[model samples]
Target: MSWDDPRPMSPHLQVYKLPITAKLSILHRGTGGALFLGLILMIAVLVSAASGPESWASMHSFLSGFFGQLIIFGFTFALYYHACNGVRHLFWDIGKGLDLENARKSGIAVLIASVVLTLLTWLIAAIV
Candidate 1:
């Protein structure tokens, strides 16, 4: 093909609808990135604790606020989702759940497990 000729282009994202497993794969990568950002929050908490009561108080107050709690809640879900999806990938590595039916089932299971685990964690924290 010459440079002046019309170049073939790949299809755009709107050209095709993604399947569940594909969507979950994309979510897995996204959650991984979110978890990395969450680590910065974790480090801030740690540093605040070591910096003394005033610093700790400020960090604690922020963490206790509604917006902060929402971020923490999202981080919790991302953590669980990344973990559950990692386990699913492990099974694939072991040559398990490679079939289309099993792959779809596992994808759904990962999402449900992530939500359940996150809720259970928050519930336990509240009770304790």
Candidate 2:
């Protein structure tokens, strides 16, 4: 590597590119992390439920509240998004959809589809 090489270093974050794929990729990682945390909470819930009526009652009261419901909804969205995108990644790992155009399109599609699925799950939980 020449010390005086005048090759222009690409300005990474300075580039004014805010593509859908970029946003989705970032969100996917974020939601995946959220889901990991939510999983621990879920295990606690299940254990509490199995413990006794007292424990179940405490969990039930919290889960019945507005804030609890909101957190639950958010957690559900994270789980769905992570699961859906993980499947997409599996496809990529198998040498499918590696092209730039297809990857970007797929990322956008996964983001939209995950929101729709999340909403559907919430609706079902609310109604039934």
Candidate 1 vs. true structure, TM-score: 0.89
**TM-score of every candidate relative to the true structure:** 0.89, 0.78
Model 2 per-residue lDDT at 64: 85
What is the C-alpha lDDT profile of model 2 across 1-128, one tens digit per residue? 68698997666777867776677788888998888888888998999899999999999999889987888999988888888888888999999998889888888778788899989998897799
Query: Best-fitting candidate, measured by lDDT?
Result: 1
Question: On a 0 to 100 scale, what is the lDDT of residue 105 in model 2?
Answer: 80
Cα deviation of 83, candidate 1, in Å: 1.0
- Give the Å shift of residue 26 in candidate 2: 2.7
Q: How much lDDT does each candidate structure score?
A: 0.95, 0.86
The window of 10 residues in a row where model 1 has the poorest summed lDDT is 1-10
Candidate 1 lDDT over residue span 1-128, tens digit each: 56787877767789977899999989999999999999999999999999999999999999999999999999999999999999999999999999999999999999999999999999999999
lDDT of 2 at 108: 76
Model 2 TM-score? 0.78
